[model samples]
Target: MSEMQDYRSSLSDPKSRKFETFSYLPEMTQDNIYKQVKYIVSRGWNPAIEHTEPEQAFNHYWYMWKLPMFGEADVDKILAEADACHKAHPNHHIRLVAYDNYKQSQGAAMVIYRGPIKV
Candidate 1:
């Protein structure tokens, strides 16, 4: 377990070339995704969806399918978009991100996993 932790820590280092700009905040699941996104929207954060193939899961430079900006009223739309991205990339890792415009940083994130880590 410590070895894996060390590996993850090394990957996160900026000089490692494997630095991740994103990460999962909670357990991966559809229900959790909706709940987290709803809470973020309630806080006035904008939602966005992104994904990447399992092989590139740790690459950090995942592809953004939808840019953040979906407002509270568009919660369902964003949720559906997240679902679609998961379906399209069933063999990949999908995530939902909420950006707090005022904070200028990611407000929250949730991942929908496809399988266990190779390690």
Candidate 2:
């Protein structure tokens, strides 16, 4: 198979409107969400949960609610909070962002799980 393309660069919108990467999921479940969070934590990166409102769909910035600086031990708590956020904002866009504390830059993985697009 041919190599996958990095479409982020081809986006016509401003860089602010683009997601961290194309590694986003159309839907997110508890099992998969936990697994992704666990994997991110295992890599020694800090996990932060962010969400955007319908009015802010094009907003480049997301509001961070739950940020667990702990390691794998905090997986359950982080996942629990994520679940809560999803439940509360069933129609909003939610995502898990992993940041490298040492590098102070966002990791390549930006897992997004959101409800069906309106319109």
Best by TM-score: 1
lDDT of 2 at 6: 58
Off by over 4 Å in 1: 1-29, 115-119
Off by over 4 Å in 2: 1-30, 67-72
Writing each residue's lDDT as its tens digit, candidate 2 over 1-119 gives 99985545322443224444453334455676677777787778877778877456556787776564445457887777777888888877677777888898876355465555444
Q: What's the CA error at residue 51 for candidate 2, in Å? A: 0.4
Candidate 1 residue pairs in clash (backbone atoms < 3 Å): none
Cα miss at 110, model 1 (Å)?
A: 2.1
Candidate 1 structure quality by residue, lDDT tens digits, 35-56: 7667887899888878887567
Backbone clashes, each candidate: 0, 0
